[model samples]
Target: MATVSQIWPFERRRCLKAHGIITLLFLDLCLQCVNGYLSSPHVGQEPPYSRDAQPVITSPVVPSPSSASPTDSDGYAAKCPSGGQCNRLPADCINCSYHHNCSYGKLASFSCKAKRGVHCTAESGKQQTNFSLSITCQFCWQLDLSQYRCSNSTSCMTVACPRKCYNATCQVLDHVHCLGKRVFQKRLYCNWTGGYKWSTALALSITLGGFGADRFYLGQWREGLGKLFSFGGLGIWTLIDVLLIGAGYVGPADGSLYI
Candidate 1:
């Protein structure tokens, strides 16, 4: 009876240990199932709970139409019609450029002088079918007509003169009365200021006439040498030169003007 009682007590201990182990295993399984059910639905999605919603405030500043920037047309003093006959009147002229819109394959023409401060308009329009319109003003050079006009109001014919002419007087050189026709030839002469002064020539002729000082001063080297060797042609040539120089009959040899 003592051996049987010891064996029965061991069997009860074994059964209690088994029941505790099974209870622990079952509790672990239930906890695992509850955790998987909580996290499985949101595996690839955002959390269901979030922060509190906030009101978004927008900017109140806005651009007004009256305060808009100005364009190029605002600076222009006038405007021209597009694809029509241009106004030739001075009152219809613009500050510089007359803007237009041109169709493709058609030319837009306008006249403007660049030297007068007129400029070519900037091209602005569609690329194809409609082309940008601009009128280019070329630089022009104008000749003064007053320089070619005569004092008598008569037009002067262009003539080749080696000596530059200024304030010329026109005169008829020859008139031919042949048959029934009259041929008139005119010539223009300038007031020439060339040659030595008559006063100086006369003074030299009176003072050193025998030595040919007057002739040398007048650029007549050959006459000067002749007078020097001939003793002023026995003093007769000297006396004649005094009269000739005073009468303004003598002139410079080179045919150039005096300083």
Candidate 2:
């Protein structure tokens, strides 16, 4: 066996070497753990589910108002009618629409000077001007009929009656002629007899003047009440009402003349 001192020194050296190897292995493990933690993706940041993300921004598309076309009250573009003197007629008839070949704007007013009709009148060495536009003037008979006369009695017609008169004959009585052979082609106005009768109204006024019967018959409710309450203005009003009704001065409440 070796001496005791020599054996003690050898064992001491082996213990120190084992301790150094363990220390080195521990330091290497610590360094590897630290490097792995630093290399991880989520080491210093919060989780994606922790908070709300910002929204992406983009430009909005909008339509231009000026790109839309104009429309009328009926939801249609106003266009001129195909036929007649629509080009010469007023723009108000169809909301300012005019013929494509027309020389002037449809809304513009022109003189009726050379135009053949009763509307054209000579005054102060100038032709009369027309600003009032009428659709009736587009028709032939409505434009002028001063030269024609109805051969039948005037009492046979009413304003509400149809244009066709089987019993009446339209004859050219004057030298002037109407355009488009409209002497009998279009409507003709004769004596107008309304719903109320003049003779009946006059009789009622004379007979029941104190009771307002005539006013009631003529559709004058307010006047009827006045006459009834005031006792026909103490008879003086009765006489005056009689004369007025007979003279055709007092008409129907509906603005229609008595027959």
By lDDT, who's the top model here?
A: 2
State the local distance difference test value for candidate 2: 0.53
Q: Give candidate 1 regions above 4 Å deviation.
A: 1-115, 118-187, 190-195, 257-259
lDDT of each: 0.48, 0.53
Query: In angstroms, how far off is 97's CA in candidate 1?
Result: 23
Shift of residue 113 alpha carbon in model 2, Å = 32
> For model 1, what is the error of residue 159's alpha carbon versus the real structure, in angstroms, after optimal superposition?
22
lDDT of 1 by residue, 176-255 (tens): 10111111222343334444676787789999998899999988989899889999999999999888777655656654
- Tens-digit lDDT string for candidate 2 (69-188): 334323321332222342343222222211122222123221221122213223333334332232221222333346566554445433332432434456543323222233453334
